[model samples]
Target chain A: MNFIDFIQAITEYDFLQKALVTSVMVGIICGVIGCFIILRGMSLMGDAISHAVLPGVAISYLLGINFFIGAVATGLLTALGIGFVSQNSRIKNDTAIGILFTSAFALGIILISFLRSSSDLYHILFGNVLAVRPSDMWMTLVIGIIVLGAIYLFYKELLVTSFDPTMAAAYGLSTRLVHYLLMTMLTLVTVASLQTVGIILVVAMLITPAATAYLLTNRLSRMIFLSAGFGTLSSIIGLYFSFTYNLSSGASIVLVATALFALVFIFSPRHGLLRKWKSPKKELTT
Target chain B: MYAVEVEGLSVSYFETTALEQLSARFTMGQLVGIIGPNGAGKSTFIKAIMGLIPSEATTITLLGLSAKEARTRVAYVPQRSTIDWDFPIRVLDAVLIGCYPKLGLFKRPRKQHRQLAMSCLERVGMQDYANRQIGELSGGQQQRVFLARALAQEAELLLLDEPFVGVDAGSERVIIDLLRTLRDEGKTIVVVHHDLSKAADYFDTLLLLNRRMIAVGSPADVLHAKTIEGAYGNPLAFLQKVEVSS
Candidate 1:
């Protein structure tokens, strides 16, 4: 379809509208939290939490409750488990993350095998943005507000804690509490993103846009805003590609985001590889 | 009242003792230096007193208040290496972190707080660099930013860990002068120092430590050959000879 045809389809179809709104909301929230995730060097942790929520999703399907509630509960448990194991043992944090996420993902696979409605399971693994219901859109909206509001309210605490936990603690802020709060926020963002990109691709949403912005900006606030803008732009563009080419929505979305990141990686004026290669004389002059 | 006091404080890592049972007190308005050989628990000692690390102590107080209660009134500058200098924050924003404890949760830094942070940067001679990204600054400038953050805390007591390691000479001189000024303003300053040569001139009181309190007194009294030998072992016999000669 041409651009005019796509715009007509968006207005004519309710499912497309819902998908677009849901994808954009997911992008904005993920971009905002992804800044903290990348800055704290917790990109892998974001991946781990996203994957570890699978068992909770399957279990919630069995119990006839909202998958989001189950996913968040299990996400928090996974975070606490990783924290506990890493803190108590000689094994490092990355090792602990590796062990816990794999075990949880395996458990999810086992549970999913027993479910009668396996079609929903497939959608959970590879997102079906076109299948997003109006209720799911509302859930995503509410969660997006909560995550954004929490970040706004505790910006300074999170900043100090992430930047220098030693100083944060010395100033009487509870570093452990701040850490767990961040974990909880990550869980919320992951669960909210489940329908947009599914578990497998959610981590891309959490890291790519933020990292792209990181390469372009020198300030965290600006990085967050730029990441959100990139995320929203990628989602809108990805939706167009999916609609026109009859492609999988989540994959297209992630691919566009990744492509944007690659573009920025090669061409960002301040930190780009190309710029650095071309500006050898600038360094000498400075 | 003493600026800091501790009784029978001890810290241990897994399968290794970091600091043995130790007792010491530091009076207000004094510039104290904690000097020890590598792995002598100099950093560990300050961390424990600040409650950054878990430890057992019979009694610990700051200005007659419990350590936990007085923590907000204290400022600490960790080693430069411990911070992620590449973080995407301007120097001004970093300095404003010192006011976080006061603002607590839910409140943003107001105009007054910004002015206070800028003033602290001015005091550190970094006001011109406030808008610059932290990673763009030199090592000494980064140290000055940390100092500016500590000053913005407006604390009565300051604890610094290895403030001079890998720093340029100009930064070193600036830091020492700043500490002396803070001291004259009646704030207690404790520095974890390694350079024995400068220790005599830098600190009014010397705390010679080696997993335990070896000595604590005025520089003239504690810089003795016997105390130096006790804290640093025979590897520094040259220091003892130098002390006797001087």
Candidate 2:
């Protein structure tokens, strides 16, 4: 289908409109939160939390409850568990994340296998944005508002904590509290993106656009703005491609983000590789 | 009022004790230096006092208040190496972080706060570098930026850990002069220093520490050869340098 055909479909179908709006919101929020995650060097934690929520989603499905409740619960539990193990023992944080997320993901797979109604299981692993329910769209909207509001109200705390924990602590800001709050926000964003990008690829949405913006700017505020723009653009274009080509919506979105990252990686004026390669001596001097 | 007061303070890692049963007092309007050799728990002592690390202390007071209660009233400049310079923050913004404690939660820095931060940067001679990314500055410039940040706090007590290490000579002079001026203004200043040769010249009171307080008194009293030898556990060449300088 052409651009006109896609626009026509968006206008004609209610589910199409919901999918568009939900994906765009997910894109924007993920981009904003991803800036902090990448800046804190917590990209791996983002991936881990996204995957760990799978068990919660599966359990929620089995219990016939809202997936949002269960997903957030398990996501927070895994985040706290990782923090506890890493802090209380000799094991490093990355190792703890690796061990816990895989276990949680495996448990989710096992639990999902037992349920006779397996049609939704595939959609859980790989998102089906076309099938986004009205409730799921509203849930995404709420999560977006809360996440964005929390960030706005607590930007200073988050900035100081992310930049220098010792300074934050010295000034009576609780770095641990800020960390747990970010983790909670991350889990919420992950759950919101579940129907849009799926559990397996939500982290990409959380990391790629932010990283792309990171390469282009040296200011946190600008980086966040740019990342959100990139994410939104990617979602709109990815949705268009998915509709036209009959492709996986989640994969298409992630690929569009990746493509943007690649472009920025090669062509960003200040930090791009092409600039360095073109003038190696000048780059070294600077 | 005393600037700092501690009794029976002990700090330890999992299996190793960093400092033990340390007791000391610092008066307001005095410049104090914590002098020790490597592994002498100097940084740990600062962290414990700042409530950045866990410790056991029978009594720890700052500016006549409990350590935790007085945190907002104290400004700290940690070791230069402790921060990630590569963070995406401008020099001015980094200094503006000092205004955060006073701004409280959910409140952004107003024009007055920004002006205060800028004036602090001007005091440290970093006004021109305000727009530069933190990583783009020299080590001395970065140190000055941190000092500017500490200055922006506008606190009664200032705690600095090894502010002179890796610093250029000019920056060192600028920092020491700034610190002395702050001290003269009735602010209590505490610095963790390792350079014994400069100890006598820099501090009004010297604290020689080696897992414990070996001496805490005037520089002339604490820089004695025996006191230096005891704290370092050896006759460091700096001991001879310090003796000759004294």
Candidate 3:
């Protein structure tokens, strides 16, 4: 549907208004943090940590606390547990993260089953963006601002560390410090976006835009800006379609990101699938 | 004080001892060469000096200060084969990474950092291809990009591992000339090299290693026939048959 119809629909209902505003703010935060996740080679970890946040939220609900605070606490706990356990001079990072995230997710499932609010377990399992409160919208906005400020302040070092950890080491930037700080920031973003997009789609929120943008550019500065734009556009379009058709907002947002990924993957100039094939053009030139 | 000093250093990879109880020291402003057979500690010593290797050796200190402090003065270029070539990065941008330390965390590089990076690229005669992707460049050009990064660091001490191993002779000459100029400008340079033939002409000091310090001195003192035989082993037997038959 067109913008006019979408705005008309949003005005007609409180739920639509809440979903549209919340998803957009959450999208920008995930876009910025997801850039870091993609560059740092931690897309898998991003998925694991976001999934792990569910149990924390469920427990928070049980204890009558803010669900977002619970998710943030659990996310930080998971990220730290992964970082700390992997540093055990023996266990690799993947195993620790794998074990931690799975157990936490299992606990989250159990808690959700027992609590079973009127909305049903799957409501939180797959996010219900339309049910977001005004506080969630404000929290997402604050997260977006913080993520932007952090990226802007540490632009040079983050870029270098992502590309060359060894060189960054010689320059006196501690890899371990950057690694943990980034994980913490990632946790913050993951938890903040959970209400709008749900656990299952958060990875796509943080990774697809950045990974797709990577195909279209090599410069770091351009990569950040383009990925943010792609993410915001995905949220807006996805929100509109969900508003018109009454589809699941979480799945719709992810579908939008996946669509962008498909477009970039097939047609991107540098490393796209279509360009990678047909070396016949090279044969002709050579 | 010496620029670098290592005493009874040892490093192992899995079950293999790459460097075994090697000891050495070098004064300031010397152009040094580290030469050995394929399995010897030539590259290992460089890694050890750069603290890239996880080892229980004595210690590596650059200048008189601790290794971390001396880092601003010391830079390293790993073997050309060590990098992932397919990583999407531009030559100019890659070289500019050297300035990251000075800029620190959460800070954008100002005008001075850019000008420094450009000057380093100019010194290596790579000013024209600054915008090219690193993977698009030839082996020599890749090495030049690495060299430009080290130069951009403005390091007083440089440890380079196999800078010219697989590149063309022209690129090798360019590297040699650039290194010599760097040394002339009062920087200490050490390289891990495999070609024993040019050991005498290329460096002011020679260090021959085979899991240990086999020899260390001026090339005139260390490049004797016996030392070369000890380092090369009996590999010349196959080459001798080809020489005779041809």
Best-fitting candidate, measured by DockQ?
1
Model 3, range A59-157, lDDT digits (tens) per residue?
A: 888999977778878887888888889876478988898899999899988888888764656766677787788887778778778878877787776
Cα lDDT computed for each candidate against the true fold:
0.89, 0.91, 0.80
Model 2, A154-173: lDDT tens per residue?
99999999998888888888
The digit string of per-residue lDDT tens for model 1 on B1-246 reads: 899998999999998989898888999999999998899999999999988899999988987788789987899999988999779999999999888888888988999999999999998889999999988888888989999999998999999999988778888888999999999999999999887878889999988889999999888888877888898776565376458647
Q: Candidate 1, A126: how far from true, in Å?
A: 1.6
Chain B TM for prediction 1: 0.95
- Candidate 3 per-residue lDDT, tens place, B1-246, comes to 888888878999778888888888888899999998888878778767767667666666678766767878888887887675655578888888887766665566678888888899998889898888787778888898899999988899998988987787777888999999999999999988877767778999999878888789999888776776667675463244346635
**What would you estimate as the lDDT of candidate 1?**
0.89
DockQ, prediction 1: 0.59
Those runs of model 1 whose alpha carbons end farther than 4 Å from true positions after fitting are A280-286, B235-246
Candidate 1 lDDT, A168-195, residue by residue in tens: 8887888889888888888888787777
**Across all candidates, what is each one's fraction of true contacts kept?**
0.80, 0.74, 0.37
Write the number of the candidate with greater lDDT, choosing between 2 and 3.
Answer: 2
Ranked by TM-score, the better of candidates 1 and 3 is 1
RMSD of each: 2.4, 2.1, 3.4
Q: Assess candidate 3 and give its TM-score to the true structure.
A: 0.90
Model 2 C-alpha lDDT versus the unseen true structure: 0.91
